[model samples]
Target chain A: MTLHAIDLSVSRGGVAVLEGLNFSLSPGTALVLRGPNGSGKTTLLRTVAGLQPPLAGRVEGGGEEIAYAAHADGLKAMLSVSENLSFWASVFGTGDIVAALRAFDLEALSDRLAGTLSAGQKRRLGLARLMVTGRAIWVLDEPTVSLDAASVELFAAAVRTHLGQGGSALIATHIDLGLDTELLDVTPFRAVWRASDPDEAFL
Target chain B: MIALLTRDLRLGVRAGGGFGLGLAFFLIVTVLVPFSIGPESALLARIAPGILWLGALLACLLSLDRILALDWEDGSLDLLATAPLPMEGIVSIKALAHWITTGLPLVLVAPALGVLLNLPGPGYLWVTASLLLGTPALSVIGTFGAALTVGIKRGGLLLSLLVLPLYVPTLIFGAEVARRGAAGLEVVTPLTMLAGITFGVIALLPFASAAVLRINLR
Candidate 1:
């Protein structure tokens, strides 16, 4: 199976941000979405993950098979690192958080409160969630926002392993993830602004 | 769904949790009413059921924002939307968690608060029963309000505004049952109506809450 978006248009706050976007992600491949800030990278990923309705066109496949990780880490500050991971595992109907913890090198901090972790550690915990999702497609929004150099490599290795296992990923981030993935720069599809645009009135 | 319920319950009881806040508010409101209205046993007995119902309603409202706002703020709501669980089930679970943490406590403590208000002996059982039957609707309806305002910054006020009016029917029937019991009048009609409202809200409002949540997330 594959994830395909056909002539997709995405908007934020009702204003069209990106229009006429198209891409296909097959199993065992990664698609890196490259765009500058405020370019609708987050919006596009949310649409593809089925978290929001696309402004136009449609995304085929990637339904329940997609696991979305947004810029916010989604961890409860009072919960331990392992508790956070295991909670997601249960929600996603998976039980193998051990692998996820080991994948992110979080075994040592598994019992630490998530709030006490460093920014990079929290990011790693957030990224570790993708492993326990038990879904084939990973939709990550700025997944490496606060990761260190070594942590970046660790994330890249996880992506590689996911791809190697016949899974796909759609990552929206400016930082280089150091993977041999196809690059789709979204700048060309940026929607033009119009003062009289109906969508602008509400904003 | 159970996983969600347990996690939310654990979070509610943890430090910085909102678990006891609603109960404390209920207690304060009940305690203050005596001082404000004066400690005349006759007047206190006359208004005890209404005052207790009002306190419990406000207590339930105080914690409504916690149902979805925490998850929405932390981005867990988005991941939850994408999870295999249906949005309706997720919303229902959240409402259930809200009841356990907020509504159920109010139910258990209503009789004690009833006593503080100088409620008559017969009013105690009916007030507790009415709260047990009615607070589920409050939690469910409050979940709908929480969903509607999930995307707004500092939405607690708006959530109360949206939820309070919807609470009228439950409050009317709930207070009616207790008031009638306190006055030693026939209570069957309001009690049945209160139970019906609770069941109906439990059955139907999750769909509305789930729809609102999806729109907010969108």
Candidate 2:
């Protein structure tokens, strides 16, 4: 089986972010989404995750279940790392957080508040949340923001194992993740600059 | 659904120190009113309903910014937005948590505050009853406002600007019932009106909030 995004278009602030974009991926494969800062890589991931409404088109075989990690680590500052994992695990109805956190080397920091953790640590917590979601597809936006070389290696290893286990990932990132992944360059959809005009808001 | 609600409620109780901070503010406001307006028993009795309603409204307002700001900041909101459950359901459960922390406690404590304001015994029931019925509406309505403001940077003041106008009718009816009860007059009219507005908002505001959140998330 394959998940396909057909004729997809996304607009933000009345400006087209992406238009008529098409791609498909099957199990045991990955796609790396790359573009400049405003190239709509994040927007594509949001649309695929069903967080943003597509300006036009459809995503099939992805269904209602997909795990998404934005560039912002979404862990609550007040919540300890384990508590954050438990919250997501409970919501997704799959209590697999111990393994997920362990994979990110977060087991020791489980009781630490997310806000107290370093930037890379918070990113690992965010990825751990994605892992416990138990969704077939992972739409990740800059999943490796704060990691050093070793942590980045660990994340790449997790992705490789996930793909080997029949899971799929569509990642948006600037750095090379070293996964045997397909590349989708989103440079063609980049907007030069967005000018604000109330009258011309429909562009 | 239970999972989301349970997690939210637990987090609201355990990690939400801010919830306690809001309740203390509500208590302080309720206590300071009599001191400011003079301890004239008659005057205090006359304004007891208005004071309680206003206090509850302010208490609810103080806590509104935290409603979705935490989730939005921490990234949990996006996860909930993408969960298999509908966005509307997620919002509804969030409203429930808000009520448990702010509205429910306010209702439970209104009787005591009512007494402090020299309200008669019968008026205490009306104060609590109105709060119980009206606070859920406040939370549900407030969620929509919070959702709208979530995307805007530096939004707390703007949130009040957008939400306060919508709260006027509920405030009017809520305080009116308290005033009538203080006078020992029949209160079914204002009470029924408050319930009607609450019912209408609870039924309709979720869709509006969800639509706005979709835009904000983009």
Candidate 3:
């Protein structure tokens, strides 16, 4: 099975921000979405993950196979590191969080409150969520923000492991994640503003 | 659903998690009413049922924002939306959690607060019973308001405005039950209506709350 975005058009705040996008992601491959700021990278990822409906066309094959991680970590500050991981694991119908904790090298901080973790540690905890999702396709928006060099390497390794297991990923970030993946520049798909249209003028 | 409920309960009980805030507010409001209304025992007893109902309603409102706002702010709501659990189930679980954290406490504590208000002896049981039956509806309806305003910054005020009017039917029936019971009048009608409203809202409002949440997230 494969994740396919057929001529997808995504909108934010009732305004089209990207249009005419087409891509397919087969198992065991990764697609790195490269784009400048405000180029709808987050929107595209959200659409692919089925969190928001695309304005036009369709994203086929996501169904229950996609796990999305936005800029917001989704980690509860009141919960401990392991509690956070286990909570998501249980939500996603999985029970084991050991692999996720070990994957992110978070075993040591398992009992620490998430609120007390450093920025990089929190990001790592966020990235560790992908492992417990039990989904084949990961849709990540700026997954590496605030990660230190070593944590970045850990994230890349995690992505490699995910791809090695016949899974696919669609990552939207500017920095190189140090993985052998196909690059799709989202800038070309950016929606253009036309002054002739009154609706466009308001934007 | 159980996982979500437990997680929410755990968070609510934790430090800085707002578990006791609603109960505290309820206590404060109940305590303050005696001073404002003076030391007239007859008057306090007469208005005690209404005052207690108002206090409980306000207490429920005080904690409504916590039902979904914490999850939304921490991005857990997005993850919840993407999970296998249906939105309706998620909203229901949140309402349950809200009842556990806010409504249940109000019900348990209303009897003691009724003493301070100089409520008649019969009014105590009715107040507790009315709150126990009606507060679930308050929590459920409040979940709808929380879902509607989950995306807005500092939405507590708007939530109260949107939810208070919806709370009117519950308040009317709840106060009626308590008031009738206090006066030793026939109380079955309003009690039955209050139970009906609670059961009805419990059954139906989750869909509306889930729809509102989906729209807000979109």
RMSD of each: 1.5, 2.4, 1.7
lDDT by residue for model 1 over B1-218, one digit each (tens)?
A: 88899899999999988999999999999999999998699999999999999999999999888889989999899988999999999999999999999999999999988878889999998999999999999999999999999999999999999888999999999999999998889999999999999999999999998988888898
lDDT values of the candidates?
A: 0.92, 0.84, 0.92
The deviation in Å at residue A18 for candidate 2 is 3.0
DockQ scores for all predicted structures: 0.87, 0.64, 0.81
Worst 10 residues of 2 chain A by lDDT: A191-200
Q: Return the number of clashes found in candidate 2.
A: 2
Q: Name the TM-score of candidate 2.
A: 0.93
Off by over 4 Å in 1: A194-203
Q: Show model 3 residue runs off by greater than 4 Å.
A: A195-203
How do all the candidates rank in terms of DockQ, highest first? 1, 3, 2
Model 1, A1-203: lDDT tens digits are 69999999999888889999989999999999988889999999999999889989999998989999998989999999999999989988889999999999999999999999999999999999999998999998888888989999999999999999999999987887779889999999999976666645464
* Error in Å for residue B117 of model 3: 1.6
- How well is each residue in B61-161 modelled by candidate 2, as lDDT tens digits? 88887788778876777878887678888888878888888899989888978778989778988888888889999999899999999977778899988
* Ranking, lDDT, top scorer first: 1, 3, 2
Candidate 3 clashing pairs, residues 3+ apart or interchain: none
Give, for candidate 2 chain B, the lowest lDDT window spanning 10 residues: B13-22
